[model samples]
Target: MTEENRLREKVCLLAKSMFDRGLTGGSTGNMSLRLPDGGLLMTPTGASLGRLDPARLARFDAHGKHIGGDKPTKEHPLHTAFYDTRSTAGAVIHLHSCYSVALSTMSGLDPDNFLPPITPYAIMQLGKVRLLPFFRPGDPAMGEAVRGLAGKRSAVMLANHGPVVAAKDVEAAGNAIEELEATARLTLLTRGMNPRLLTEAQIRDVVTTFNVEWDT
Candidate 1:
């Protein structure tokens, strides 16, 4: 098939995976990817990710006009924010993931680096996931909040909401978001036990070796 068709199918598959895994049940997540031809393929609003039809994906021009397909997700501004701020953002995924949202509200979670170095994989997969304040769903303030990061964070957790992640492509964006959720799960699972985590030096080595965006 063509490139557009491939991306469209990928979008549906990833969205289904998230929904099926309970990451974002119902109609809570939105996904969008920039096409090589300067267009966009996005999931439609009010559609459950678990049931997204590839043929119904919304299509938009490079100028943001709705050219075809179904209505775009209302979280368009949140998606556009990263695309505008991060030049490297080719695809963005926003999910109402459970653990990440719960972790966002917990005390002692550092804003500078939300997830601790429990594992080197988290460090390698997610440079630094920012924790952003909660905004009403579909509020443009979310876009502003993401912009405030100044293109530094690849992922951000919305208080009481879920996480939004951007990456070089749709697959990477989904992978990064999954890593965020997994780390959040680990954090919750080990809370109060004070589990032994990766040392500072080990984390530093991972960051330095992988050229990660650890601002520590």
Candidate 2:
């Protein structure tokens, strides 16, 4: 099989896996991967993650022109923002996962770091998740918001919406976003219980050991 076909299959499989696990329900998530030829392969708009068609996935040329396949997700700008700013970005995934959205709705959370320091893996997989203020669905401003981060973050939590993550590959992006959701769940679970959190020194150690891009 050719490289694009392989990527198409991989995108569908991973998207379906995420859907089956209830990470993002309905048609609430989107994904994109950088093609080897400097183009992009993206999930079509209005398609459920559980039901992506590899053959029908949207294709874009290196210059961001739609060359073939179905209509691309309206949030392509958001995906491109990562690719434009972060040199290592190979894949981008956005999901309206329950816990992350729930966490975003809560008041008084830090916008700079959405996920509390709950687990080492969250720290390792996700550097610091920025929380963006809510925008109307499909708003271009959302992409601009991500652009303003200047590539310092690999993940972002959309307030009253969901989480968007960009990583070195599809699998890594999926993993990091899942970690974001899990940490949000933990945050809600331990809220008001005053659960002991990793101290500054411990967090520093994790960052140092894992080479985390922590915004210290």
Best by lDDT: 2
Best by TM-score: 2
lDDT of each: 0.89, 0.93
Compared with the true structure, what per-residue lDDT tens digits does model 1 show for residues 82-114? Answer: 988899899999998888888888998788788
Estimate the TM-score of every prediction.
0.96, 0.98
Tell me the spans in candidate 1 whose CA falls farther than 4 Å from its real position: none
Q: Which ten residues in a row have the lowest lDDT in candidate 2?
A: 110-119
Q: What is the C-alpha RMSD, rounded to one decimal, of candidate 2?
A: 0.8
- List, residue by residue over 172-214, the lDDT tens digit for candidate 2: 9999999999999999999999999889999999999999999
